[model samples]
Target: MKKLITALSVFAFLGFAGAAHAAEASGRIAMADPGTSTLTLEDGTTFEVVEGVPLDGLAPGTEVTVSYEEQDGKNVATSIAPAQ
Candidate 1:
């Protein structure tokens, strides 16, 4: 039981370490809109503005920071918001 627990802990630690590195290597963008935001990343992009979340007050040329992640063999969004 003790050995198994130790192995699992190590695995978790390594996974977290890898994630930290991945985030650092990723690119970041910024947005000017406070109500709505959109960011373009590597192979994928994130957009918060839509029919539901309209960019009514958002100014043009607003940049959004986003990160990319692979999911089901497709690049997907990690996070997106006004580049702060």
Candidate 2:
């Protein structure tokens, strides 16, 4: 019973740790490349846009907020929207 509890606790902690890596960034678009499905901010932070996240109307100098997760040393964007 104790070993099972410990294993469950470890799995829960690992799951939360992965969730903790999700983050958001607000900045002006420095570059938006549909061919590569990537967006780069003015600060040089680049994010890889996941499939199904529309990039329409996004362009250089447009302010946007990016929701992303750090995966395998790259920022994988889950969503992007214009900044209010």
TM-score of each: 0.30, 0.80
- Per-prediction tally of clashes: 6, 0
Top model number, lDDT: 2
Model 1, 15-36: lDDT tens digits are 8767632131234333334344
- lDDT: worst 10-residue window of model 2: 14-23
RMSD of every candidate to native, in Å, equals: 7.2, 2.6
Query: Model 2 over residues 1-84: C-alpha lDDT tens digits?
Result: 999999999999999787747799999999988889999999999999999998877979999999999888899999999899
Q: For model 1, how big is the CA root-mean-square deviation?
A: 7.2
Clashing pairs in 2: none
Instruction: Return the clash pairs for model 1, or none.
Output: 29-65, 30-63, 30-64, 30-83, 31-63, 31-83
Error of 2 at 50 (Å): 0.2
Summing lDDT over every window of 10 consecutive residues in candidate 1, give the lowest-scoring window. 21-30
